[model samples]
Target: MRHDHHGRTHRLELDDQSLRTWDSTVLASDPEDGLVLDRSAFYPGGGGQPPDQGVLLWGGVQTRIVGVRPRDDLWLVPDPDDPLPPVGTQVRGAVDDDRRSLLMRTHSGLHVLRGVMARDFGVPVTGGNMEPGQARLDFDLAEVPAGFKESLTEKLNAEVAADRAIQVRVLPRAQAYALGPIVKTATDLLPPDLEDIRLVDVVGLDLQADGGTHVASTKQIGRIEVAKVENKGRGFRRIRLKLVD
Candidate 1:
């Protein structure tokens, strides 16, 4: 199976992160299992990023997609009150641009934070979570290094101001791992059976095997404010950040 495909659905988002709308055919639709499309741009939630919400239009009607079930077949969860397009129906699918765009920026901003942490602090991320405009990443560090929050905030915005380019690529599993500890986390979450690895690189800064949407450049991430830094005990520190306009 190709990395760009999830079961029977040819995942359009993986190839074109900027794609907001497309046309596709309904391959399966059920009240219980939800709808499956021949081609879909709806990004199923993964890597701390939530799934996309959108709508499918057909014959003067619309079925709002609220969530996604990433099973053997990608199942698009529809609004319970909305109507589902029957199989074989041609539908126009549209992703919520505002939500997805914010997510891309927020996800990219976190990468900049990760890069700064690894470069300056020499710590590994233990866990993290994100929403549209805000995110938090936990790192394995014993000392706070005095004025850590203020210092980190300055470094993060500097990278954003520098406008570093962000690139995405797919490489064979062995070739990806050969780059020397690509995973920045304390725990390795990558699947062992995967043959192809998708990588996101913040050029000249950080690179890791990731399956998430991101902006084209650090400049697009805008201003990153280190909101808070907490001591989670046992040498774990949680850093919360927000994107400022």
Candidate 2:
């Protein structure tokens, strides 16, 4: 299967073996970076997060990998007409760290708020967006009171101030099943066979089967402010939030 880490770490550096794995493509000789790996950790714009872009280096040539997508396997596509490096060639792969860090922090921040909403308001999330510096999530709630939004804002800020640690781990499918029905019913994802399940836990705040990168701790999320709430009818409310300086 695909060796993925998009839901695990924010920034990762390549080592000897991993680097070799990335430079094995020989199909695009006249290519840009000419680097291609059997599997990649880059998130290809799924579940509301956008695709990642960065540069790959080969023989002093810096080629831009504009987009990453899953084909029969995950193919690292460089600019148009770019050739692939000869198979057995070694190249370096790098992700745009600044943009990746933003996604990681913002995505974790949204989850922090999500867990808080579930605990305090008994509202379940209907949908959400994990964007850079901006995020929004919808919940199934009766009616929105004027003070509710402000109250939530204060609560989420406190959670961030708590500085809780965030942890991610891989779990066997059966081992994960032992955690109980609460989580099993929440996600439709299954570990390939029984060894590919990955679990993301926010210490005491939240736990779920997720495949996205996140901040190491809640404190890194900074100040979360509830910007607005939209009533979408049928006890559905959407909350908009932003990071405060």
The numbered model that scores best in TM-score is 1
Scanning candidate 2 in windows of ten residues, the lowest lDDT window is 12-21
Q: Which stretches of candidate 1 lie over 4 Å from their true place?
A: none
Show pairs that collide, candidate 1.
Answer: none
Candidate 1 colliding pairs, count: 0
How accurate locally, in lDDT, is each candidate? 0.95, 0.66
Can you write out model 2's per-residue Cα lDDT over 9-48, one digit (the tens) per residue? 2123211111211332323333543334643445566555
lDDT of 2: 0.66
**Could you tell me how far off, in angstroms, the CA of residue 68 lies in candidate 2 after the best superposition?**
1.4
TM-score of each: 0.99, 0.79
